[model samples]
Target: MKSYSAVVALAGLVSSVAAHGFISSPTPRQPGQGLKAACGDQVYNQQSSDHFGNVQGALQNLQGSQPDCRMWHCKGVPFSDAGEVFDYTPGQVIPMKVEIRAPHDGVANVSIVKVSSDTVIGQPLISWDQYALTSSPLSQHPDWTSFDIKMPDVSSECAKAGDCVIQWYWDAPKISQTYESCIDFKMGGGSGGSAPSPSASAAPASSAAPKPSSAAPATSATPTATVPAATPTPSKVEEVATPTASSGAGEGSTLPKSFTIDSFITWLRANAGSDTATKVSRAVAERAHPRAFRV
Candidate 1:
């Protein structure tokens, strides 16, 4: 009975094989030859594999034990080991997924800076506030983190047709180690047409008023009196009063010519409306410039 069952199973396998024609000599197909058969011929929907065959090469290097690969189960996996697949279009939201492993105790701060020509000196063409990843902690094992980054508008001058670099930096303060991974994405679409020229609207013409030719004279009998200009007088220069000489010699006489003790004292009195300045000036003057009595 066991022999009969095995023979029946063999017959069923042979029938399945006979259904599809078999090739005696296998002929390897060229790259992209059967792509249309697998997916539609539409440019946007067309699926392609890695040209250089290096999807795994772009992944972050892992050491020791790592997290199990969950990318295949995820909705949006940024890149496949076979190759990166994306629709080249402007004004579309592109989803990005990256696997990050902390392996040690620390915090990870990820910042994305988009470079384009329209990016001004102070302002960025694609600001970080526009797109960002939610704050989440990474465990020691490998973890898949997913985020979406929108492509900048094509109308912006900064937009260019090329690969856009998405840099991921993992910082571990406790371990003092950092890991960075850069993924290059190709951008498509030609520049949009030039902006429209502004038309100059003509302004309305203003009307001018005519001036009066003749003027009426005053009817008053008494004419207004005109005052004669006074002769200009020259200002007299007043001479400053000189200090009277006293037949006395004192410490003030020994003061340098550049500085006058009496004048300094007078200035201090005028400036020192406060009692503190008056007392300070009086004490300094009495000690430094005592008056001498004449014999």
Candidate 2:
């Protein structure tokens, strides 16, 4: 009887880990041949592995162990150079999947960054709130949901740079937690046929980082080789309540990364030039997330 009870307990534990929320579409966490695999470097899914971290806070990123959106450090997964690289076109429409094995209230953001070095992280090329602007993955999708994402164009230089990161951040506002993932890849295909949508583009590929100011131009010019100015701060959106995010947010964390329905709508409208952001104005943000409002 004792042996049977122990076996049953262990089985239950394994089931819970496998049943946690995970990104199933791109398969970055479990990428096979040809695509770089970095998920195994840290606590791929912490709350489960031995069930060590906070379970209810399965999405948390700023606390013990999983600091800065991830535990892999700023230079990215160590020895990543030995890993594989996924090949993609400059402007391809990519799809994403987030299996909410454990559904919770949150928002998702995806962005592109040029990995200038293994030691230094790069800036954003595109940033937007996937959940708030188009549809609420929280309320819209079933347990395991899949959605199509429009890819953005890269500068000829950026496309040829050979390495970049497609970063994803998930914020659980109701729970004050966040989850993160990245797909490393090499760009393929020709350039310049279609520019990135205004709603999708964020930081300039080659320019210095945008200064964190209330008055930065909505449409800034392309930059040269000089180091960028100060990091751009959250626009007026910082006034809203927000949870502390992973230090890993860097320059690519979008305005909706820290949302309170209001900030989300403001960001969505500015970039998308539509009323889509406002559509989800009732969104409740953190004490529950890997959250932010660019603040």
Candidate 3:
């Protein structure tokens, strides 16, 4: 009787952990051979088995583990494993979809993230302050499950295929679980192509367009490469400052002027009080020391 009860409880726990979310359309990055090499077989297998698992879970598995995994960035999936790179233009509107097997009320956003620095380029393309709320059924809130994000003009930095990614970030802060999905893309000349409409169950994709918000442009005459300017907490749909020398890091403590992953990690460590920064910093510091980084 005791053994049977234990087995049932374990099954329930596994089922609960497995019920999560991930990007379904625009085909987010997947765990593959490169991931197995960089992250090691264990971490890669975990994600390969369950792509919807949160960052914290993956980090937990990374105790004194692979430094090259970069688990906090796109769940550490490498671009070499990325099968297709979508060609996009500045104004292109791309259809997107997310599959939430279980809802956990929190916030979500989509942004252009520079792979090199793990920094968001400009503001988020779309955001939801109240996302994946369990009070309402997924059927009633189609916007949370399906939407569209406009590609902002990132031609200067994202002209190359591997330089940037369209990243979908969802953080259920209450649960301390962060989920990310990245789409590999680059800017291409010519008119941006039209996207197919989302499924009938989806809310009108037009409704997902975020309100305009202020953010600093990447400056040319690179000032002291500090952290970045302030960005809103993950709970709100707000602007994300560009990570550049002119943008400044966080408050207090100055490292070298050149902005790199090390600098960003330094910033993350410095800004450890912040909700987003702190969580990510802890995972990064614990799992691996700074290694050659890519998104």
Candidate 4:
């Protein structure tokens, strides 16, 4: 009877160890090592649910729905398993890795797209090709699979200095097989991502200056001098001419021609103070009396 009891106790211990397969613990809130779920059996049905429930109960000490299963559509949510959020700058290339546990055979499709207001507030930041899992059939068993994704450059038109959402979809094909998860990350700051160029900052500076008025007068007034008119006179030889010739001459012949010439010389001397102007006047006067001023 003692031998049989020992055998039974050993068998129970073995079974208990076999029930938990690979497990990851929960992270700590204070930034140290987090709690991880112990490795357990890879069964997706009721057994997997019980295993996950044990993990959640151990951490939170609660009897509510399983931690992993509550938020996710899977049969068992890994205890203390949570996603993380990160920020990226525009035009930055980011390498990312994700591990997802599916309960059955299905495909996981990841993708990023411009987020329209109608569909969502922020834009899509990353996506991946559909990853199909068929090794473990629909046994409701929790099997973990990992994937590496490279994010493309974010365009300024699609994303701005705001928050963006990254979505992860597991078992997306069938109606009842869909599971959705998301992480909210911001894009901006002097991180690895590119920022909007400095040229954009200079645009407002140009518009701050005031414009000149068009109604002001263009020119100011200043005084100007008017030139005197020249007076006409009869020839000097008219006075010395015969009486007959004088009588036939016009009425202007009675005026003294010498007096008019003298008045012109006096005005020229008064205006031509500089020697250069006097020389120019003399040269002009000589032209009228070429033969007399030859010497």
Who wins the TM-score comparison?
3
Task: List the candidates ranked by TM-score, beginning with the highest.
Answer: 3, 2, 4, 1
Determine which window of 10 residues in candidate 4 has minimal summed lDDT: 286-295
In model 3, the runs with Cα more than 4 Å from the true position are 1-19, 192-201, 204-295
lDDT of 4 by residue, 120-239 (tens): 222223222222334533222222222223344444533442233344444322212333433334554457432222222222122221111112212221101111122222223223
Runs in model 2 lying further than 4 Å from the true structure: 1-20, 30-84, 116-144, 155-162, 189-291
lDDT of each: 0.25, 0.37, 0.64, 0.29
Return the TM-score for candidate 4, rounded to 2 decimals: 0.29
Which residue pairs clash in candidate 3?
226-249, 227-248, 227-249, 228-249
Worst ten in a row by lDDT for model 2: 282-291
Ranking of models by lDDT: 3, 2, 4, 1
How do all models score by TM-score?
0.24, 0.41, 0.65, 0.29
| 2 against 3, candidate with superior lDDT | 3
lDDT of 1 by residue, 5-95 (tens): 3433442332122111100111111123233322223211211332111111112111222243211111012222213323234444434
TM-score for predicted model 2 compared with the true structure: 0.41
> Taking the tens digit of each residue's C-alpha lDDT, what string does model 2 give over 157-228?
345433556655544433333455555555656432221233222222232222221222233221112223
Model 2 local distance difference test score: 0.37
TM-score of 3: 0.65
Model 4 collision count: 25
Best by lDDT: 3
